[model samples]
Target: MLNADTTDPAVLRELIAGELAAARERTGRLTDCVEDDELVAQHSPLMSPLVWDLAHIGNQEELWLLRNVGGRDPMHPEIDPLYDAFEHPRSERPSLPLLPPKEARGYAHDVRGRVLDLLAASPLEGSPLLDAGFAFGMIVQHEQQHDETMLITHQLRKGPAALTAPAPPDHADRLPAEVLVPAGPFTMGTDTEPWALDNERPAHRVELPAYWLDTAPVSNAAYQVFIADGGYDDPRWWTERGWAHRQQAGLAAPLFWSLDGGQWMRRRFGTLEPVPPREPVLHVSWYEADAYARWAGRRLPTEAEWEKAARHDPATGRSRRFPWGDESPTPAHANLGQQHLQPAPVGSYPAGQSPYGVRQLIGDVWEWTSSDFHGYPGFRVWPYKEYSEVFFGPEYKVLRGGSFAVAPVACRGTFRNWDYPVRRQIFSGFRTARDAGEEA
Candidate 1:
């Protein structure tokens, strides 16, 4: 809640610093799970080397915090060109001069030290970047995002499991099919959130008719039905582009799933096991989710509808920062921050339920929505153009609700994540929606 309560500058600074430190700690933990060689290895052509992301996180922090926010000199000017994401695609990162794991760790550590010092002396007002501690929050969010990317690299890497987490609490209760979001106009996006990125800015009212959203994300058991019904083979359920991509990729099941001895199994991190029927299905592309919705006689919720379900509080005509309430996420609330390598049971985390009784709307997996990644009405790029402006197009689909691999600081009810429809490496899933009058 970096900007949720920004009236007290001291408190805001402390929260910002704490969030930054926590994000750094998580990055270090994820990187430490593997050796230096693994860090340098490009796990997938689609993702940068782990070492590249490690340094790039530090590079971004230095450029934004030390250079822009504090008006300090660049720490390593030579490395700037190499780490620029747009300049070097993931496929070319390994061929570039990336700092070794040890050096990258030192650089990130040093950047954090300086950033903390700047935060201590920096006034928390003046420009928008400092007015609400936006820069610090942005840096924290950027690092957390990269940490999530690194986790994806780990997922794509062919190695023994290098990460570990205890299983989430067991919950056996069955969830209802859908929850009705009382229709009308509900506030969407945020004008007051200090650290909200450009795409999520300028709070606006979105009007929608009454609709029904799934109580929780589609579970593995539910997705299994789609596979059984030849959801992939049937062209009727897919969009033109989606059907084309499906045919080209020859996708039969989710990315890491396979059938062994007539039992559906999935590769989780480093081990293969029977797919957990109760868990939210992970690593599904937007196309697959869309087709599944069609097969189930439902549709992916529009971004507005999804946000309305997660943020709108019908009783008070207000939007909560998270599904549960205005308070920040707690351990009991959501399965996030890579605390668990995989999603918890779909019905778990009852405390995180929305006002409409929508469960797991904020965690589990990055739930897909039907909307494209377009700028909000009155959206304007602030601070930087590339952070969001570059990705504003129909080619990318929006995904809401942070996944288990997502960090709390990087997630909010308004936070937006988008990717190509064919991307299944990131933790993604979907829950279906339909008009309120529709029969189930």
Candidate 2:
């Protein structure tokens, strides 16, 4: 199917089923990589036990697809509270009465089998949930999202490497210093994207002044210059709150980074090596990104500016669904789906460049934006308000573009992910931006 064809029910069904299977396969791979003990253990206070997420994925699928969309009675309704994320924070999840790894796998597989049956038999229309198979898409995306979380856990765990992938493709050609995104109005969000989450809704036109954005994500080499220049010690570059947090949190460098003698070394999924100078810096909190931009005499782009850089196609006078084009991502276009397990070097993926010749906007690293998380104009609750509504505030900073750890199923130009400014556990990075007229 070209896209989620709500008009053609059969095509939608096929699309839903395929994505469901793909997500499940990835989930299974991620969970099965570790032992039952590891699955039950919470690798970090910020993340749930892998087994909890495994069962929760199934629980959500049963709740949304089986019960809400198909009108089927719940299979394990009694255990719903255990997997309810809102009911318990990540720090306490490992202590909960979660199913063991085997049981979790069985429960998820059973739910998947039943969901498939429902998908085969149910009508794909008549309600908002069923229309265009939104519920199925949501479930698929949710599972894939949890899979990304589990991957993060893998990164945090102290052990032998649990996953492996070939390195991201490299580009020898040098990238431009920055790209000019001419000032213009562009639709900033999506009204028609089948699986776009609530925050990215109500397609609104936003007029923005011309800006210059880094052609690629900030590389480790560049970030090191900031660090070597005493960027961490200089309070002038940071916001007051950021400076306070930097002292309180004792953040001297990006997470997982250490200065070994004179060389900067980093741990990646249990492997340690000298930081790759050419690769985009990873695991940087939004605060650090903002500070780096300020130190460099620029600023992080606002959410709208980031979107315009990623989605707006000047020649067509329309926003494409991705940086490269409307078509879904592939290995050739971007480093995504944990295929490389790390960001590709800067200047890689010329094929994925935006119309203005900006590179790697859709993947490699989730780029931090200056905007806070908020609902678009005309945003409304769908399925549940807790997913997007509760988190809309200045407390959270918005990050655009999926990271290498992010699944393509859960990412789009219109897709929005947010977290606290101090979070660096996530595979996050940023590219600096400046007003078009700013001095370089």
Candidate 3:
């Protein structure tokens, strides 16, 4: 439930100003300890150069929100050719000539300031300029996106020494295994929402029969049962593709896991410690989730079913941006803001439960769905063509919600992300669902 009055020009300006301030502060922290040369070095495959990423954020705002709508020239016309991400995809990222680190930071600060001033002076409410609102939204999401990436990237470069240790896992209690959802029609996506990505538009109707979904993400203790039962060795539990992948890679369990003195230990950040049975299982790919589901006599929910259980407020036909409604996220609500930067004990945030009583729906670990990564009925390409069109096929599967490293704003209920079936470096996990009338 976003402020329905977000369209108020003054409110929008103030919001934009606040977000700009936050972005600057976060970005400053990311670059604070880096040297001039280190900023341009390729730290990891998951991250781009810090200097390049910083410039891209500012240039993106100028290109899409200001130039596209306000018809203004770029603050630095010459740098636009080098730093524009929309024009250069990730594959070409390494080859781009980058600005000096200090210069890049200054350019970003200058551009952000100019954009804020422009937004303050413009009449955005009813004018055609209103469409730029989406661009503003996009910029906000983009900045948060990099903030999360920076966290992971820093870990890769400096090892786990860069991050603070997470709180010890709590296994003192375990929640009920499942919650039953009644049979009904739940709106699947957004239609006329003030701001929605193209993938979330044309809010179509979907009817799902009654089902029982896990009240929380699968826990380490449960997944350990799968491993102990030789679940990975049994071909019957895996799809043909999954079996092939398992055999080819000799994967016996989740990455970053091992046995120590017959007890399970997992790698978090960089330290190895006893596996916390209550923590949601993580780093499992879609194939792994599917295999685990099959072994458990259940299945991953379709994106529609997942949304019906996790977002739709049956009483009002409205969905929350987060499972907990419109309030900005807090550490108490979910495992966001790098609070722990590791999966929390499942069901740790009862306040973050969705309307239908689905717990941990917003964050803990991203959940895999059975949906293919495809666009909606009237899908049209945005400025970044590669964003959606290139990934449309069986090669990728849809993932819902956000992971520990996810930024709060980027974890909105309708924001969609996709990954290849076998790539599982991300902090991903799954919950099980059974058909109507099934026993928990």
For each candidate in turn, the TM-score is 0.98, 0.98, 0.89
Q: Please count the clashing residue pairs in each candidate, in the order shown.
A: 0, 0, 0
RMSD (CA, Å), candidate 1 to true, equals 1.2
Residue 375, candidate 3: C-alpha displacement in angstroms: 1.9
C-alpha RMSD for every candidate: 1.2, 1.2, 2.9
Shift in Å, residue 218, candidate 2: 0.2
- Once fitted onto the true fold, the runs of candidate 3 whose alpha carbons sit more than 4 angstroms away are 33-38, 75-92, 126-132, 158-160, 165-174, 316-318, 380-384, 437-440
lDDT of 3 by residue, 1-440 (tens): 12445766677778767776776677777777667766787776655777788888777778877787678876778878787656776556667877777787787777777787777777765543355366666677788778766765665564444456467234323567787878878667676455566677667677788888888899999999999999999999999999999999888888778898899987766677898888889888898899999999999988887887877887887666668876767777778756676787877787778877777787778899988999877777764666678878889899998887776767777778888888667778999899976655
lDDT of 2 at 375: 89
lDDT of 2 by residue, 15-99 (tens): 8898888888889889888888899988899999889999999999999988888788989878999988899999988888888
- Which tens-of-lDDT digit does each residue in 51-162 have in candidate 1? 9989999999999999999999888899999999999888999999789989999998999899999999988889988888888888888999998998888888896888
List per-prediction Cα lDDT, in the order shown. Answer: 0.90, 0.90, 0.76
lDDT of 1 at 431: 92
**Candidate 3 TM-score, true structure as reference:** 0.89
Candidate 2 RMSD to the correct structure: 1.2
lDDT of 1 at 322: 92
